[model samples]
Target: MDSSSAIHGYVAEFEKAEQLVAATRRTRLAGYRVFDAYSPFPVHGLDEAMGHPRTILPWLVFLGGLAGGVGGYLLQYYPHVIDYPLNVGGRPLNSWPSFIPVTFEMTILGAALVAVFGMIILNGLPQHYHPIFNLERFERASQDRFFLCIETKDPKFNKTETREFLLELGASEVSECEE
Candidate 1:
């Protein structure tokens, strides 16, 4: 431990996806909540091992689509019925059937847009910096390496003990992250 700097966490490198998953499960069982696992590609059952809950993205998208549909309907209704009444081709000014296509398109647009933005925001995207990025070999994370990090903020974090625990899990190497 350095006196001038603060420790952010400890990162452990694993050789295989299975190894990472097993280590993650062990870590979770060991009562460490402030931890994360990283893999080059998606690994099955990793979320279950990490004990992450289901997301509310589906509900958010549904509400966004509903709002868009209602707004679309009102936009056309107000203009053709209330703002300036127009009886085109003997059809009523408040003809809701004619507004269906536009409303449907707007609904799709709203849902898609909300999904894109919501995922980005929810996942904390556009983050250009993190303490993990300070690791020299961390760039391999996007290539072939797998990593599991136990943050210092964890209630049960003990730097020396955590390092030894990761080594016991067969980590290829363990690095300390400082911020």
Candidate 2:
């Protein structure tokens, strides 16, 4: 056809946070999955409307902490118990009490590090460019407006039908994004 091959998706603008949230809920019910919403500030209950599953970052952080704690304990145990076995005050070689501080510190460190890295990896951060940025109206996203975007990646997406669907949702304006 035309240059439609460059089309990435469609973005629908809403005036109110309520509209965005309701539109998102309806869109999900209409079987659209590959979509995202933007808002100037956190909107309560938006996550439920989006139907996003719980994240695994918490579990990852927990595992990181467990590993770090074990590593830290072994770090001291290996050196003090088997490797050198120094008898400073004739305290037990295991010295589990002293290991607690290092283990605790390592646990916190690992959890913090994993939390940051896991969030970055999960959210697909760094050096990013998205077709959504191509829309001039998107500049308002971080300021006042709210938006909903249906990406071409969704199997249910159709250019004509999706556009009409957004219009039916009472979108104030709709703009197409190009890849």
Candidate 3:
């Protein structure tokens, strides 16, 4: 029954997105880094309020495409030029034009695959459990409620202080999350 001993973190339930956003902003300004908010729908400007930086998934996908393109080109070039050395129609061994289609196809395939898998990796998916799931009311997050969590990993986190801060930000209810 001791609030100070909760290892998980603190969670604040908000009835509205505006309250959640404002609470996120205040938590960020108060110097907490490990925090996140969840809502039934995307909240405009919530990312800014939470101080989230842009994700690197786009760059990862681009690099994946580049690798696929080069790999595809090489797959065609190596066998045709060095392995088999086809002399059809007196065309040169290093026929750049013939390689274009496969290269383009591979590029598109790689980008699409990376877009799906990279997003999964970057977003830390396949997660089946989190401390926040301990809250029975948290199920409402997918229904209509907004929830903000300040993780114990945050440097400024103190179970009591964080709870009070959330309440001060007009949270409808503040509860401790258990790990």
The clash numbers for all candidates, in the given order, read 0, 0, 0
Model 2, 1-179: lDDT tens per residue?
25556877899999999999999999999999999999999998899999889999999999999988888889888999999998878778887987899999999988889999999999899747978899989999999899999988888988899999999999999999887
Q: Which candidate is the best by lDDT?
A: 2
**Model 2, global lDDT:** 0.92
lDDT tens digits, residue span 16-83, model 1:
99999999999999999999998889999899999999999999999889988898889898889899
Give candidate 3 regions above 4 Å deviation. 1-3
> lDDT values of the candidates?
0.90, 0.92, 0.88
| TM-score of candidate 1 to 2 decimals | 0.93
Question: How far out, in Å, is residue 162 in model 3?
Answer: 2.4
Q: TM-score each candidate.
A: 0.93, 0.91, 0.87
Give one digit per residue, the lDDT tens place, for model 3 in 1-179. Answer: 36545667788999998988888898889898998898999999898998767999899899999998999999999999999897999989999998999999999988889999998978789888877899888999999999999888787888678888889989889887787
Q: Please report, as a residue range, the 10-residue window in candidate 3 with the lowest summed lDDT.
A: 1-10
lDDT of 1 at 108: 92
